[model samples]
Target: MTTTPAVRILAIGGSTRPQSSSELALNVAAMAAQAAGAEVISITGRALMFPIYDTETTHRDPLALDFVEKVRTAHGILIASPGYHGGISGMMKNALDYIEDLREHDPSYLDGRSVGCISVAYGWQATVSTLHQLRQVVHALRGWPTPLGGTVNASVTKFDADGSCQDTGAAEQLAIIGRQVVEFAQMRQASTDATAPSANSGS
Candidate 1:
């Protein structure tokens, strides 16, 4: 008999708005990942108030440390950021800067891990730029990016009064991204296990 390995997914966003589209998208994505049989943990930048990334302050902040560990240990990562100006938000960049800490200490943490990126922007133009920035960051971290990514443009309609999504189509797109991430992660995990030497192989 063989036991299946559980997939761990971490979803995060770059916005601190009270009812941000980025945050809402993360929640929707998490639901999709759960439906796809992956264990999902979602994190919002608004939940924590870690100061901007700085070497001198890391030791003083436990949340920052925890955030880095979550990213390091996750089997798959879903990152969403709002387009600020023409690129990724500064808050998202700040969080990303913290990833540099993992490069030397946890070199293999991101290797082969599945990654997905999403961008929610006020206009259609920002979607491409924001997602592109996220892709570049994930590549630098050495994670595999899923083929399908979620990109929501608000140029079509206003978000709900509560800042939630009113469009069923956008919601479904987010869900699709979640499912894709889990599937990719499972496939990669299987590939890894296949190549790994069994405990009884050399007996």
Candidate 2:
């Protein structure tokens, strides 16, 4: 009997600051995706620090190239961002801009992939707005946004040093988002595989 390969879920986000709440929240979600049987790859903190995205640059930064490669192969994605001025932080936005490199890929820009999004901010206003913005970005990229997106109000909720969320409800919701992404990715993969021509069948 053969087992199915684990789906690859890439988690990316967070600001420049160390151990940020947004990063911690992303970790929590990534953990949940792992629990749901995905092979999770997290690109956070210093890994996110790359030259700002420019469409006309002849020389591409190594780190930027690495980031693009990960996105190209990931079956799904989970993004967590800190709210800045009622939207996503500049760092997170810049990282996402690197995805433009995939424009020439076969499926292009996250097409046929599930994206789980979360936004962390001091208040509900920023959290909601940032989450909405994230979903909009996912839609523009042609990715499927999970049914449940998370809005974490950091003013009242807290995350532990070990990347665990302190608010039970918030934690559960984030986990649900992660699981949903993994589930959708698996379904999509299975569908694609089923539709492909068999090796033994001659074209």
Identify the candidate with maximal lDDT: 2
Q: For every candidate structure, what is the RMSD over all alpha carbons to the true structure, in angstroms?
A: 2.4, 1.0
Worst lDDT run of 10 residues, candidate 2, spans 55-64
Top TM-score model: 2
Q: Tens digits of per-residue lDDT for model 2 on 1-203? A: 55789999999988778779888889889999999999999999778888888878857888888888999999999999999999998888888988888998999999999999999999999999999999999999999999999999999999888778779999999999999999999999899989989777988
The alpha-carbon deviation from the true structure for residue 66 of candidate 1, after best TM-score superposition, in angstroms, is 0.6
lDDT of each: 0.80, 0.93
Model 2 pairs whose backbones collide: none
The window of 10 residues in a row where model 1 has the poorest summed lDDT is 156-165
lDDT of 1 by residue, 100-189 (tens): 777776455467778888998988789888888888888887887788777888676346755456788888888888988899889978
